[model samples]
Target: MNPILDAFWYILPAYFANSSPVVLGGGTPIDMGKKWRDGRRIFGDGKTWRGFFGGLAVGTSIGVVQHLILPSYYGSLRIAVEVAFLLSLGTLIGDLIGSFIKRRLNLPRGYPAVGLDQWGFLISALCFAYPVRTIPTGEVLFLLVVTPIIHWLANVFAYKMKWKSVPW
Candidate 1:
């Protein structure tokens, strides 16, 4: 597959794998805020054990897949587990940090940060992987800028299709 197209295709799945945990229902910010608050605990009623575990599962799975598919780009199989761990943990951590910021700002959950949430985890994942493997700073900035636009557009269309409850 063409490299650009391949990256484009993978972008959404990667974003989803990272951000899908914060679901919005009834298209209401308050409901999402409640859910978000409940989700803050180690295990609680909001984010849910399911969503946390699911995010970890999906994030790591994608890392493993990336390792397997592009060993050259990632690293040896031996490092794959470590890479997956970093990606999963870092992705979640990014969201957690974002949630913290949102809370401090009283933004409310499901309120949407425009593109920040969509791009935050991706940037965090890449940065977390930096010690293990290096990527150009330019590339990092590219993802920060480009991924959100792609994510925003995708969410808009998905909401229009009723696949998603809100468009951010």
Candidate 2:
């Protein structure tokens, strides 16, 4: 496969993890409707249990299907599942961490934090996947360069579709 295509495939779990939340997330907030001493919502209403788990399920399901259809592409079924779970969980965690930091900075929910919104998931996914898989330098670079663009585009699409309140 082309290196670019390979990189995209490798990062699909993270992409799905990052994007699915906007569409699938709702219900109770992850912070359990709590607030900080500063009177800010802990993670805001955006970080929800439903979103977190739903994104994980969607991303991991995609990986499982990929593994079943193209086992050679991801080495093995077990490894693929591990990588998928790690990337998906990491993406959700990263988003939550970003929201936490935003709240600490007094930014309102859905406020644009530039790189934080774009790179947080990629950074966390890389960190989580590092223990399970060795990502080539080229692929890492490709992901870094491409993720923000893809994220921005996806957010725009979601906004236009009324799935998201903001197009970050």
Question: What shift in Å separates residue 36 of candidate 1 from its native position after superposition?
Answer: 12
TM-score of 1: 0.69
Q: In model 2, which regions exceed 4 Å deviation?
A: none
Q: Candidate 1, which segments miss by more than 4 Å at Cα?
A: 1-16, 22-46, 157-163
C-alpha-based local distance difference test score of model 1: 0.60
Expressed as tens digits, the lDDT of each residue in 37-89 for candidate 2 is: 88888899999999999999988887898898789988888889989999899
**lDDT tens per residue, model 1, 29-124:** 222444344354221223444566677777667666776777765447657656666766677677666666676566655568855678677867
Sliding window of 10 residues with minimal summed lDDT for model 1: 24-33
Q: For model 2, name the residue pairs that clash.
A: none
**lDDT of model 2, residue 85:** 91
* True-structure lDDT of candidate 2: 0.89
Q: What is the C-alpha lDDT of each candidate?
A: 0.60, 0.89
TM-score of 2: 0.95
TM-score, one value per model: 0.69, 0.95
